[model samples]
Target chain A: MENLDEKFNETIKMGLEIVKETEEDRLMTLSVGPQHPGSGHFRFTIKVDGDYIVYCDPDPGYVHRGEEKMCEYRNYIQNIPHLERPVIHDSTNITYSYSLAVEELTNIQVPLRGQYIRALASELNRQVYTLYWLGIYGIFLGHSTMFMWPLGDRELFIDLLEALTGARVTHAFNIPGGVRNDMPEGFKDRCLRQVAYFEKRLVEYEDIFYNNPLFRQRTEGVGILTKEDAIKLGVTGSVLRASGIPFDVRKAEPYDIYNEIDFKVQYMKTGDSFARSMVPFLDMRESCQIIRTLLDKMPQSGEVRAKLQPNPKGPAGESYKRVESGRGALGYYIVSDGTPKPYRVKLSVGSFRNILALPYLLIGSKLADMPSIYWSLNYWPVEADR
Target chain B: MSSNQSNTQNGSEQKEKVSESVQTSLSKKTETITLEFESSIVNHLVTRFTDKVVQVVYVRPGRTKILVPPNEIVQVATFLKDTLKFDHAESVSGTDYPKDNQIEVIYHLSSYSDEKLSSHVLALSTRVDRNDSRMPTLIDVFKSTEYHERETFEMLGVYFEGHPRNERFLLPEDWADIPPLRKEFRIKGR
Candidate 1:
């Protein structure tokens, strides 16, 4: 006390005040979903101080069926529809990937034309499904008419798909070596007509949704995932593409008959909700172009179905086949032990990664901003939950 | 990708720099890169733990199946997320090898990169003695593991230690004793 002068006494007082202010911070754990309307099927609890959610813990598996366990009991053929149900919107991707698994296990070749049609059907269904993402994006933003138009127009593509595979959502189209059916009568003509119709309607889609002020305001800069943040989170597909990564499975690691076709790969440099939303929307048109090339270039051949029964010789192998589903890089990791059924078939699902990215996107935003961010993502909860 | 991307020429000017310091280690390879790291080096990985041998098949290949012991399931999972850079849990699956009397619980981890897409699988496998059915809980590492571990525990009758919230995740919430995914859990038609 004797050594300290008036100046030293004031510095001590300032240090004491700093410690008092530091003690004012607070943390809380608020669970967001598993049932909440905005957060989807899984739940995430975020610890926060007012608006800034600091720690986000995602608790998924609300829909786990132990399907892999069930797959062991079911025969190889019976597993297609079961796998499709996990992410129902992209059935062709699942069926084709699974079919590749069975074929890779058995060592059979799907006929040339059959492979082309498989790619054609998958990409065609992709356009309609891409439209599905767009419609959901619109509805999430509260634009009822933009919601109705693309969805209503999407029926044209779905109708074409129905004629080819005899079902709407889960066609179970691709079998061990090839597709279940060939393109129906006048299918190419109808497909060409649908393409023209979409070309005309695309102007309206741009006018109503893309150019709309509300849609832009809601998504333009929301949920900005830095490229580094995305890579670290293990994000894939359009979400990663939007972050400016140019890697596309179609071009980088082509599967099916993709290497034979000539088409453009769509990407976005800005990693935001708007960029993420833009991907499937553009891929829809690119799908149309690919289908046009297929109609012109499809090889003239025999039956679409390949060796329709169990392989007699029992050859076993494994391959990680990937395709550009409307979403992103959809891959099937197949393992076989020379059996009719897969020894194990594992999938690296796309939507699961997309689903988890929401927390990083949601943290600082308001509760009201949830739907805009959620819908813009086009992530399916059952996909992650599975 | 264009010819520009395929080239390996070094021109160092970028808006976002790709470096060794980035959280999730990034790599781009020309082949279907398959690598086998020495166990001594692998033992030092973030996902590595005691009593478990973490073999990094490829630092970049994106697919891995960690060999784990029954009791140390929780420890390995904690090490993967907290120590290793594998931040997000992708999916959890179980496989019943009736022949071996052992069940494998696979935990898939997705990397957080806009860097590269890779998967790290941790397989916690143990023999189901039929007399004593028990395994450790991994819910602490991956919050999502609660349901996956519960369903496996229910249908396959594998027990989990310290399950935070263990209830049915797949079958109807009120349904009795696992609704049949195992070979022995008989269904009439099959």
Candidate 2:
């Protein structure tokens, strides 16, 4: 009886606390958005001293779909497509990598051909995501032309994805053993077209965004994180690489067809928004090369999903898998107890890593620069809140 | 970086590249392959290493898990930074191994050098006295431990000893009850 009351009291307290806001001295407490174009699906309570943010408390949970807990409740095989929902743009990469690791743990094998296809699809998605990030960062800095270019051009690949996977955003193609949909007919030509098309656009992107003085003024030296500080803050993905650490999991520890592909690990030493800008740009170029290589050199025929007696949950065990997402290195730590559902599931979301360091970084910067800094780092609120 | 290759007695020229161990600039490391390393032997090996004072403990297998006591964590982390030179903490994760009545804080550390690709993960583990749940703050050693530790404190209710600020890092301040991260903290009734 005492325990029940104690638990009940605790719940009520938590319920109230979630609604509470900071009482920072405010000339006017400006609410950024629940639907503002600046924020995707979240709100920020900023105490503004004229044009500068005196204090910024991010009001998350607007997009909290309970992604982590939902993963726990879902079955082993059911979780394949679900985990990718937060960052639907990078669906194949995160889902495929996670399924691969989980399959590895339960002693399932995805066939060599499947591995190559998975790699191919992931690389393709990486290019699309990079362009989207660049576009978002462009608009964040007030350049609409930069935003429209990539968003418009991104369709060609989306078409390629639709033809192959039957869905543009939710490419639940990856199954436990292998992909649900195999490469369709004429995919090679269409894929090659976009791949070649991107080859030309890659330089144009450099000319328009990277070389543009205005973009540099907004991005370059904006979020300068030193090598030591980058490590300290636990920043991952492009943010870490932008600090000039060539730590790409694909290169460091190869998974799928990464070992066979020959490509350079791209990084920028400046550790600023400009440096952050270069990551997706260079990455997209490298991905284009990888897609071409994988397509040209892929084996004629082999199995896709590994042969496993049963895809049922393995004995009580745990597995941690980190794969490069559009934002950074996304890790999924899953624990099982010989049951249908997971005993625990914790998503080490990529954007959340960059999001947590905001108060420290945004403390003294001008309020106007917040949007640029946010977009340049490429934080997806749904992914972060997940 | 020096690579140590042991000669194959039967040289069929099959070409299997095997190294006994590779040198990673001032530190010699052999891949553990999987997460499972015998705790007692690893402890013995830690004592044998010269130049650097560090300890590696296996927390769990199949998962990249490790465990380290607070006393050894500071020394080992310092050695990893100054001696072996792993300057980055990639992820700071917390686990409530309630069966063992212990909480594990895992720091995934890596080097900036290209030659050293495989991360040398060392687990820092301390079991809080269940009733008196407390462990010294690791924020002093690894600065990033502050946020992770606070999250752990909020979720698992594992008391952090001498934490610079025990204030909420993730959850709201006025929230009630102990953290909900403990493995045994059953949600059935709630």
Candidate 3:
């Protein structure tokens, strides 16, 4: 009877301990999870002291399909479909980097016209991606009209890409040697008209979203990532450029025909949320200019693709190539052991790098500023998780 | 009066010389140079740390690989950051060589601060034993390498010494099998 009484007392003590408070109890933990519309297939745990966030821990990989591991099983050509899936809206740029690395590995020279057409598709795809991001960013800030405008304008470019690649989202247009198809007949005039219309629409976006006093008040001085901190954190694309570093992969390390093309690297001196949001818009404007230049400079006629065996294999070597994708610098590091399948493949994405700055920026900020700060970093969670 | 005029002339000449030197140094810092196959950057790194660098080769015009011992990675990374101005790590990737019984970790280093070196990507790599994979972390030198190192650790089971967060990054909390990137860890139905 005494032993049973002692066991009951111990069980009660354990239950009491579970309810006891510790240092962590002072702060309430909230999960901005995948279910949350703002979080978007990613989650982060944050410790809040009332309205202020004290700690942030980003938990990615909810959408991780083990892309790097999957690359080993599939042959070079077969990898394109799934590889482009991570960032489907910006499919061309994702595969463009892979194709460049593969071509370097196999010594496949893309034809002159093929190079121009590839650049054209890449520019069109950039508009599609940025517009989508802008639309989502608008809804995040509670501006529904801001959401509608960019998405509606995005269809113009999407139509152009569909005509060129024969797919709406998953172009898989870029292959190892060259693009899957040449520009369709009348593609040039269609692209020019749409791009000109798109440029006019950009001005309206500035009026409604960017120049709004409410939008300016929320984002102007918030989540300031200084130049030094941005470099130390290794954030890329608009985030890096917004912090005053004019280091575009196209300009810094031009791949294929990017060296021949003349376009300015758009950047901002201020590294605040406002600057980060503005940089991508500026980049879209620059992309339009680039598309015009590429169209003008493209050769009149030439073969689009290089002939290759069904099972293409390269020498025992490795190659790393980077392309300026919509999100940022999407690079592929491929290792080949003279086989049809790659030994190892690593995709170094900008979204992954930019997400590192989240914890650093989110702490000490109000809960209301989370969406503005988070979306301004131009982070795409799926790509980061991949 | 003539002597005073001569002194002023000498002073102006010295001022011009100083400005010229400053201009030259500025140009040297920001000048965008084409990265040749046998570039001077590779030669400099090889010659500077001849003992630590096991092998060095030009993978392509802009990409160079420098292999160092696992033990001396921190030292080499520091030199690359401070002296060579390879400001940031673009990516940290690992490859498992089951035949060689080694797992190689490669840090693709590039520059943003120094425009002259911006075009070049210097891959600093080290190979550790597959079973007993442990290498000193470069996070102290390159702060941006923290997440990349964490990802590499969880994926490959390579322990990064001195790295605070080496736990599961991308993998699930209940991951029980071996690291997924390892050659032995096969994807089902392959």
Q: Tell me the docking grade of candidate 3.
A: acceptable
Residue A178 CA displacement from its true place in model 2, Å: 2.6
Question: Model 2: residues >4 Å from true position, as ranges?
Answer: A1-36, A42-62, A307-311, B1-45, B48-64, B70-72, B97-102, B113-120, B129-131, B164-190
Instruction: Give the DockQ (2 decimals) of all models.
Output: 0.12, 0.21, 0.33
Error of 2 at A117 (Å): 0.9
Q: What fraction of correct interface contacts does each candidate retain?
A: 0.19, 0.33, 0.69
Q: What does candidate 1's lDDT look like per residue over A1-386, in tens digits?
A: 65677778888898888766442357667787778766567666777766665666666667766556556556678887898877776788767776765665566777888988888888877777778777777776788887799889888977888999999888888777788888878888998998988978887788888888888888888778887766655566778788876656676646667788898777797888888888777777777788899888887767776665653224554445556666665656565666666665556566665655777788887655667766666676676545
Report the CA-based lDDT of candidate 2 relative to the real structure. Answer: 0.67
Q: What is candidate 2's CA lDDT for residue B102?
A: 64
Predicted complex 3: DockQ: 0.33
Local accuracy of candidate 2 as per-residue lDDT tens digits, B26-144: 11232344322323223332433321323332233322233456556665667556655556555555566667766666665555542442433433344455555666776666666
Across the candidates, what are chain A's individual TM-scores? Answer: 0.88, 0.88, 0.94
Q: In candidate 1, how many Å is residue B4 off?
A: 35
How large is the C-alpha RMSD of every model relative to the true structure?
Answer: 11.4, 11.4, 9.0
lDDT of each: 0.64, 0.67, 0.88
Look at candidate 3 and tell me the lDDT of residue A251.
Answer: 94
